[model samples]
Target: MTRIVRRLRAVAALPLLVGACSASAVFADEAATTTSTTSTSAADDVAPSTLERDVHLFVIQKDGSVEEHDDSTLRANTTSGVDDIAQRYVWFNKDIEHVDLLKAETIDRDGVAHPVGSEAIRDVQEPRSAGAPTFEDGVLRTVIFPGVEPGARVHLVFRKTRTKPLQAGAFAYLVEPTRGPVELQQLIFDLPDDLPLYADARGYTALPPVTANGRTRYTFEYRHGTYAPIEAGAVGYATWGDRLMVSTVPDFATFAAQYRSAAADPTANDPTVTSLAQSLTAGLTEPADKARVLYDWMRFNIRYVALFLGETAAVPHKVVDILRNRYGDCKDHVALYGALLAAVGIRSEAALLNLGPFYTLPAVPGYGASAINHVIVWIPELHLFADTTAGGIAFGTLPTGVMDRPVLLDGDGTLARTPAVQPRGRTTRLQIDVDASGTGTFAYRVEDSGAPAELERNVFRRATHRQAQQIAADRLRQTGLHGTAHVSTSDVAATRGPFATTLQGTLEHFTWPDGTTALPALTSFAGGLATQVQAWLAEPERTQPWVCIGGDFDETAEIALPDTLRVTDLPTDTAVRDGFFDYASHYVFDPATHVLQITRRLTAQFGHQVCTPDQFAQMRGTLQRIERDALSQVVVKAGRM
Candidate 1:
């Protein structure tokens, strides 16, 4: 059974459920088929495992109890499949659900069945790292199949009974099948005929609802013969797969109202909270400034805990309690921050959203907390959203995880979209000096803003000294330079403003003093601007939309040569401009100082999160020109030019 709790649910795992063998699965359903088949040349190209049958059945009672049954069978085709699929895990919320495993067995290629013994099944609490605090109350059941090998099949049957729904008289479910080869897959639902059900069944072939025994049963079936085509750099599967969502709640507006009602007055009129909010904003007049002070206080003072146990999974703890503990999860941070903002006479609302790769929200509301999994604060007056849980992020700047995503604001009747991270200016400076022995010592620095800055600080803040050194060396090597590197940076733990990282290193055989050699392009130092586009150039033809971020990247290289050497030639300046992006590279030589200077810039203005094939094509052309110019050579002789 799949844990229906929003925070506990696994988006990718197929829930085990009751098997309905009466209806035959149709693999030729054109509407829901998103995969393509290619003729295999040999067994080596075959998929590791294929689902023989995947079935789910849910029975919803009027009193809000749910009975879920899942039965699935998978056949392993290779040794890798055996190793990966021989073990199965089922998770259930132990607080409100009980699970019973009815059958577990392995069927060999010879058609002999080997039933799993009780010793092979173990029920235990969800595994977490030592001393890591969690709020989850779910337990896991692990099943190990004995004598499982290639060409064998594993079968399991389980049932879960929920004593009561998390929300009274409200139920929701998201049904998404795996993008893998399947012989058959079925979804069956039995609900009271009087219950008003809202469902978004896009890409699924929904059969006519059958009303019998004062109940209506809804069925959706799908099957695919081949694995789905996974494009490189494509969006998440939930965005493009055959998905169906069913919920008793009508729309997002209703969900928001319910959430607001349940989470009202958590921080309202509290004397302690009011006092702290006043002191934090005592010297600040602007609301934004006061908000920033509160945000910074929360980030620096409150420790984040991932516990989502029971009702706290959706409702935040009392603001006073969270303040006393000096720690809370995302919701806790939002509540405490909201209380402080309220005390300062600034209004804010709790905004609910998913912080994962999924961007699109289905029409129907989700049940068991499956709809939205994360919460932040939205200040309408400032027209800015703040995720205090996101450490090292500047105020008014949202991280990429939730940027441009739909959000449901508490008490607000309509849904809203968060602003996207726009193209920001980033600069990379490289200072290089080459000796007569062909060795170059250099200092590389990259200054970044917005999401890039947050990412850089978070990475360095967590990296050990040895790991940081290895990272610097790896980054230099990626730019076609072989060297040893030591890294330097500003206070990485600081929470405000733009951040910079510097790498100082020595490059072996950096240049030939007597002949022509291309000026080394420190490609990696551009912070993925030059190197990333160069990689995209390899995929000239793309059928799916490419994930891309728009930004302006500039790199300047100041190269000082030995006193005995001088530059006689330089690469010609080149520029390419298109609708999607612009690229340019320039080189200059100084005769008196025996030095060379190179500057390369690439500006991508996608205006959106994804780039179409046509847009990528144009960008690719511009990048090719940039790459050529970056690889241009400079001539050096043993005398002045």
Candidate 2:
């Protein structure tokens, strides 16, 4: 696991002024800077500005309650001429801080570079012994937590100093800890002490009239004056973090050497770990084999407990306690695995990767040691990246959809380009090719090799006969198709690996307009996930960056009437690919056999934002088109003889 640098990458909408402006002019006249009033050149306010910055974060756990932590930080430099924006954002909640070359560099707003000119000590209100804070290169960085007493306050005070006067379009960022589900809380911006108020937030509500916990304090604002523009909808947010990313250790040879060295030292022998190694030593054939055996043992034995914290999460717990106890959350799981492997002659390091089940990267925000939430063992041998949090998962595959996000650990951590965040196994699409005759013969087969047996399990687990009757049928009912579904039996051939589950069912009086057939034209792509589609249409347009983009299906049905009704209409056999839409719908009709086949595939991982009015209208119409294509009773004027 390599330690990565701080990062920031994309945006769906530009919330700045209509045109670009030069940031240097916002504060070019040093003589004019003496006044407390805001600067002139409102034009420069909307244009992107180059900046050099540093931030210090402190986390305190108050003592009573906690859930699951997903937080960390990032430092990145973006150049767009005078539109350059080089900023460092530290994202750390409780568990994060992977180290590497601490020396960092920066270039300022006027294209000039600078280094941190000062470093000093500041006592946090924590009880734990803090680390020696320092400033090296251009970074004024520190990792410290004077432990917190039970029922005490958790205070995180972060300070940021920049190279130029803060103006319009100039963003000063400081992120907050994400516990679980995020709520929209009021934000207070920090205006210059001497200068009267200057800027306000866009898209979000104004500062609150009341404060809940006076301790929850931190905010950013543009220095108001000539250069600042009071714009609406151009807001800033301190959002959540992505999930942990693990890989097979790519450098197995080096890891093995490190492990052997760590194990030979008498001082490094931990009693609890030594005992466990003894217990499992019989299974070990070689150093790497022992490391793998140890890794597998942790995955199978340990259970994931949901314990959320703010700062203690940053501190890696002693692995000795975790393995002996046999239970822990994301962080503990990694520490225990790393410790066990290290003791037995397999090198294991505590590297932080973003947790995937929560948010994503590049699109949302980037996290370094400061923002990492979960922990995992880096098995450099065999290039294995393991996350013990997911129990029962096989040796090579990760549990579900965490993959491709920039992993910031020890090596490969200094790259400037953030890795593209992709939901690993989501590439495995769920394809149900069912052949329904008298009794529907449903087939569960994956189109892509990435599609695992888990996808089938997830589908069959929810596709209960009763559930299908209620939701699936209700959705079909909305399509003007009448039917009652009874799932006779649903059996998954293999749950341990890639295998299919056969879903055979009985649907009586299933009818569209013509009285007999059901076609692929009647798709559940939208109607099936009507609720999800609605949410996608309504609010929270995009999921967190680390979040996977895949649709969970309810049911896919194909019916053959008593060989009577003829196929009528079909969905548009067309698909359009745009940055915001990946959609295709097709309907096949064989009038000779009175069978209508419908195939609908929707790829809606467009930008995190929702569809525009035009997009939404088109989307809503596509549903109607599919329904209409699936509808339409086959017309046949028969004579009553």
Which candidate should be chosen as best, given lDDT against the real structure? 1
| lDDT value for model 2 | 0.34
Q: State, as a TM-score between 0 and 1, how close model 2 is to the true structure.
A: 0.45
lDDT of 2 by residue, 1-641 (tens): 11112222211010011111111211123213322222333344222221122122211122211111112221122223211112222322222222222333333324333332223122122222122111011222343222222211112223222222111112222133221111222223232222112121221222322223433222322122222322122111122221111111122232223222322333235787767866786766676667656666776687666432112322334565565556766656766776677667677554444453322222221222222344455676656567666654444545542443334444333211122222222111122222223223232222212324444344545566576446444533554533343232234423244443222233333343333343333344223433344434342222211122343232233433334344444445655455434555455556455444545455555332212223444455544443343333333211111
Q: Which stretches of candidate 1 lie above 4 Å from their native place?
A: 1-44, 127-134, 265-269, 305-313, 367-371, 462-470, 512-519, 523-528, 563-569, 631-641
Score each candidate by Cα lDDT: 0.70, 0.34
Model 2, runs deviating above 4 Å? 1-296, 309-318, 343-345, 353-370, 392-407, 410-499, 512-520, 523-558, 577-586, 600-641
Q: How high is each candidate's TM-score? A: 0.88, 0.45
**Total backbone clashes of candidate 2, pairs 3 or more residues apart or in separate chains:** 67
Best by TM-score: 1
